[model samples]
Structures are given as C-alpha cells and as structure tokens.
Target: MNPAPSHPYRAAALLAMLSQALFCFRLSMPTKLMFDEVHYVPAARHLIALSGPVNIEHPLLAKEIIAGGILLLGDNSLGWRFFSTLAGTATVLGVFAILWLMLGRVRPAVFGALFALFNGTVFIQARIAMLDGYMAAFTVLGIAALLWAMRAESSGTAWSRWVLGSVLLGLAVAAKWIAAPFVAYAAIAFVAVRLNDARREGRSIYAALNARPIGGIHRHWPGMAAIPAILVLGTVSIAAYFATFAPAFFYTVQPMTLAKLLPFQMQMYGQQTQVLPHHPYQSAWWTWPMMVRPIWYLYERVDGAQRGVLLVGNPAVLWGGLVAVAGCLYGWWRTRAPALLAAVGLWLGSYVIWAIIPKSLGFFYYYYLPSIFLCVALAVSLDHFARGTRWDTRFLLLVLALFALFYPVLSAMPLWGPNAFHFWTWFPSWV
Candidate 1:
C-alpha cells in the first residue's frame, strides 16, 4: 500500500518561511508606536547600551533578546522590532514542531503552523517590538521540550529531553513572571515519575510517605535510571537560567534569601495586586471565552487626513477561535488528545490566574498570552476533523484564506471608509 501524496513538509516550511519574512518586513513603514512599545523601546535601548540594570516589574529575557538584535542592527524602530519579528517567525516553526511532537503526525503540524501564521494576534505582536511574542515563543519551545522528555523511552534520551525542557522552561519564566504557574505542571511531572516507580516496585507511594523515615522513600524510587537523568538535566538547565541573570543577581538573587530584597519583591507584587476603578478596557475572564471585548492596540488616520486605521486581531480568527474552543472541549472529551489537554491547561490556567486576581489592571491585551494556546486548542480540533473529512479541511482552509485576505484591511489598513476606519468600535469598552 502506498501513502497518499501529500505536500512536502519542506515546501510547507518554505512557504511558512516566506510568509513570516514578509510579515516581519511588510509594515516596515513603521506606522506608529502601538501600546506598550512606549515602555519597551527605551528598555531595549538601555539593555543594548549595557547601561545599569533597568528596574522593571516584568522579566529581563525579552529585553535581552531585543538588546541582542539592537546591538547587531543599530538602535531604531526596525532594529528594536527585529527581534520580535524573528521570535514571531520562530513561533510558526515552534507551533509546527510542538504539534508534530505531541501528535506524531505531519498533517496536524502543517495545519497548526498555518493557523499560527494567519492568527491575527500572532501576526500583529510579531511585527512590533514587544515582549509578548517572545514570551509565547519560549513557552511553545518549553512545551515541545517537555513533551519530548515525556515521550523518551531511554534514560539518555529522557535526560537530554528533560535538560532541554528545563532550559526552555526557565527561559519562559525569565520572559515573564506569569510563567510561575507552569511550575505546577512541572511538579506534576516529577510526582508522576515517583508514582510510576512505586507502582513498579509493588508499593504505594503514599505508603512510603506515611512510613517512618522520609529518607527511605528512595527504596520505592521508580526507574533509578530515570531520576539521575532528570536531575542532571534539570540542574544544568537551572544553572544556565541563573547564569543569564547572575550579573545583576549574584548579590541580589542569593541562595540565602536576604531581608532587604523582600521589600523590592513586595513592591513589585503590590503593583500586580493593585486594582483600579473603572478601566475602560477591563473585562471579566468569563467574557473572554466569547471574545466580547478585544483590545484595540492601534488606530490611526492615514493619507494626511483620514481613510486608514488599524484594529487588533482579525474578527474571523478571534471570534472563530472562540467558537472553536467549544469544539476543542468536545474533541478532548471524545478523543482525549494529551496535547490538547496540555494546551488547555496552560491556556485556561493563565487566564484563570488573571480572573482570580483582585486587581482590575488586567486588560484585553492581557488575554493575548493565553490566546496562543486557545488557538492551539482550536488547531487540535481542526486536526482531528482534517483527518476525518475532506470537507472540514477545505472549509477551514477557506476560513483561513478569507481571514488572511481581510486581515490586513482589518488590522493594518484604513479600510473602514474615511473616518469610518476607526469605526471598529463594536464595544465601547474596547475603545
């Protein structure tokens, strides 16, 4: 039997490469600074100049990446944005790699890559100098490495995977403090390993735990071969992560926690915890599932007077993914794709953290981080359908094609008709 003729992954990769390059350079006119570019541009400059450590609430990894590009490209709009575009480009490949790793299928990987490329949030954030895209890139990389570790059958292979996973995971945290929750999942993996070992030894882990000496817990250690593998990998990765911050952190980020450092952390924590009254763009997490209020990051008049404007995510991609999340839930219920489950956990977990926050500072863009995983969830469902029906693939391809066509007009161009370009105010809260 012969396999059905399919598009070569190399061809798809080439197309993906071209699209990302075009996307990175397309809006080279550099219309105007959008949203947080105000804050991060200066931050990148300081980093490139190797000035004093910039005291910031967020993590330093994104700025470090931007600094690298600025050093090479020279400090300017494009120079600062260059790293973001590259990270965005890398994200397309990352999505493909992650899907392939989790599902062990090529078709899903292609669909995932295509969907990620056409996604409006991805497209916009990737073009600008911003931290969000870098955060997403590291996150996807971490997920891919973690999945690789889980699937490895040999100690050597597993150790390599774990080390890669740990390095990437640490990078993720270094990209954003929000990544702290992912540690929960990491701990789950360790506990899972211990449980498997105890089971193999015909002893309940709980029994060992309830026993007299905690030191004897190693007696039931599942797969002694695997533990060293994980520890070595984890240790080295952690070392690398700390090494990046060590210059500023050697005295600050000490092994023995200092009382003075606690106040700085306390102040940072306070900012995240503080809630403001009546933020126009603020909305509840419950509504995010429905895509009710999307943040408008940039809107401007072009052509010397009026006519051109730019909004956020393409409505088709944003709204379509919202509905598709339901499909993802159903698909997961039916098939239980572990990849889908993992994505849902990350996506929902990030959002849930914000929803529970007493602070009102979270905004529409706050949803941006979680949106990537939501798209993955949708992609997983689409992959399931693509395998079952030709119509589904064609339908989704059409939807994406239509989205790509309208995306520029909806996102970057001033197509709303004269001042109508700014008529994207479907929700006053989003204004």
Candidate 2:
C-alpha cells in the first residue's frame, strides 16, 4: 500500500532523518565538557595540535574522529562533539538498516529504529563525545554489513561484505577496548557455522578416529570461506585497529609496532588498578537492567535552574525488553529461527560479559551496548505476534511518547528547579 515493497528505502530514510533531527535537537549545550567528554574532547584537541596522547588506554581512532569534527566545525562544543553527533545519528540509521534487513517490512524497520533511538542509553550516549556511542555505531554497522554479506548470492559480493564488516568490527573495538569481546564473538560465530553445517549433512564424529572422509564437514559455506573466514576477520580487524593509529605515527616513530605497543599495553593494564575519586552516581552492572542508579554525565544548577545528563535507559523500552527477551528464548526454542537466535545470542552474550569482568571496572553504562540488542529482541517479539501494522504502530507511538516525556531530562533542559527531574526519577536511586 505504501512505498514499493521491493525496497523500503523511503521509510528507512524518513526514520533516520527524523531521529537525527531529535539527536541534533541541541547540538550545542552546557558549553562545556561532561563526564567522559573531558577525557575525549581534550584528546581530540591535543590530536589537532599534534601533541602527545591524553586518553591513551582507549585507542585514539575515535578521538581522531572527534578531532576531525573539531577541524570541520571549529573548536567549540559543537566541533568537539560534531562527529559524535554524526555517529549517534548514524547509529540510529545502522540499527534501522539491520532491522530492515532482518524484518524486511516498513513498519518494524521504522519502529525498531524508534525503539533504539528512544532507548535512553542510545539517545544520551550518542549525543556526547564519549567512546561508547562511537563503539556502538561501529558495531551495528559491522553487524549490518555482515548480515548483508550473508545474503549475497555470489562469492565476490560476499567477500566484499565480509571485508567491510571486518573493518567495521576492528573500528568498533578501536573505539573502545571493551568491544574486544565482539571479536571473539566473530571467531566463535565462524566455528559455530561450520559445526552446524556438519550437523546438517549428517557427518559422523567417528570420522576423526577412522579417517573417514568428512563428506559434508569440508563443504564450502555459502557467502564466506570456511576456515579462512576467521583469518580474514582477524587480519582485517587488526589492520583496521592499526589504521586508526595513523595519527599516532605523526606524533611518534614506530608507534604502531609491538615495541611501543607492548609498553602501552602494560601501562594501560597497570593504570586500571589505580584508584579514582569516587562518583556518587556510579552503579553496579547487575543493578543496571533495573536502572537502580544512574551515573550523571553532567550536573549543574544555573541561576536557580537545573540541567543535567543522567545516563539511564527508557523505562518502557528497558522494562518491556526484559519481558521480551523471555519471548525470544521461547521463540528460538520453538522455531529455530536464525534471526531470533542471533538477537537472543547477542542480548544474552552482552549481558553475560559483565559478570566475568571485575566489579571494579563494570558499570551500568557497560549495559548500554547490550541494551541496543535488547531493542532488537523486543522488535523481534513484536513482529512475531503477527498483529499487523495497527498494533505495532501504536506501540511505537507509545515509545515515542516516553521519549518526549523524558527528553527534558535526557537533554538536561533548564528547569526552574530540580522538581522536573523528580517527575521523571521514578526510583530514589535515580537521584
């Protein structure tokens, strides 16, 4: 009934454009660095001047992106944060692209983007100059590319997609070291594919002992080379990581080599143990899903008015996703849907990563990445209901309503007093 069903390009574009406009609502505010912006904005400034590194533990690629923003927009809050503005907006588009690819419908494609865009974490993180937003942007793009590659009908098309995805994956990790786990996910995914292929072809495990030729064990995987796919992913990712270090080359000779790299790694590893001044808003990872506490990225009372940035997920989306994930698990068990499995796998895997990390390093913000996938999981559940456009559209409107209600606090809009914050702060811990 709408844009040609052959492609929902117009709907996707409308969704992305509108979301970008919301994220760009106040491209310049506070006129000063917020929490981690203090770490990254200065690094970008230092980068522009060709000075030594500032936030070295995290790679400089994303900072370089910020620096490019500075170069293009002039060294104001907007300039320092311009690329982040772009990254944050692009993340919405990336999520939309992935959803469109998976669901292949206009309603879910637009609603999925809306779900993620309104996600308090995605909304807030994308607007600022922190690595989390950029990391998320690259990751979704990488995933979109990988999924596109898998759908390719020809080897050439598939290889191109893999190359693009690998580079994006490397760029994703370079933005934040925390994303390194995704690389492991990539490798593990390759192994899982081969194992599944063997299972489908009825290959026997006894072949290892009997030297029986694994008839289907070595069958060529569609769209990607079997064993070598892992090598390609690893190699391209490492290359992508080093390429972001290009700015380092200008500042230090042999900066990308193992000689300088190993020492930097050791220093970064050592610095992780150093104590930092305590933050009042810091929260444990387990408490994040419930949003028991929110870390304030910015807080100030100006002339009897209050404006602050509190990193918290949207209540409806977060609470609903919590329930929808169960539906995902149930659906995966029932239908063996690959998309369902991928969504559930990523949602659970991202949360499970926090448990293994030392509590000292874990925070509610670490939950941000997984929360993006949770939106996907939620969208998957909605699509499964087969309720058609009427129900899903209304649900999307409800999500947008929440975003509108929370936008004042999400953007730290000036309020006569702290009273407005209280309206949205459902939990005492949120204060």
**Winning model by lDDT:** 2
Q: lDDT scores for all predictions? A: 0.62, 0.75
lDDT of 2 by residue, 1-431 (tens): 01214677787678768877877778677678788888888888888887666677788778888888889988887887767767877787787777776766666767778899888898888778888888988988988787676556566777788889899989998888767778778777656655664566666433312212344223322545445677888899989987787777566423445467657766765665556666676667778788888777776884346887878888778888888788878887998765677778878877887877644655678888888988887787788764465766777788888888877778878865656677777778877
Highest TM-score model number: 2
Report the Cα lDDT for candidate 2: 0.75
Clashing pairs in 2: none
Model 1: per-residue Cα lDDT over 36-63, one tens digit each: 7787877767665556445466666887
Any residue pairs clashing in model 1, and if so which? 197-222, 308-414, 309-414
Task: Quote each prediction's TM-score.
Answer: 0.79, 0.90
Off by over 4 Å in 2: 1-6, 201-223, 252-258, 273-277, 302-305
Candidate 1 Cα misplacement greater than 4 A, ranges: 1-12, 53-55, 189-241, 246-264, 275-279, 302-311, 334-340, 409-411, 414-418, 422-431
Q: Mark the 10 consecutive residues where model 1 has the least summed lDDT.
A: 217-226
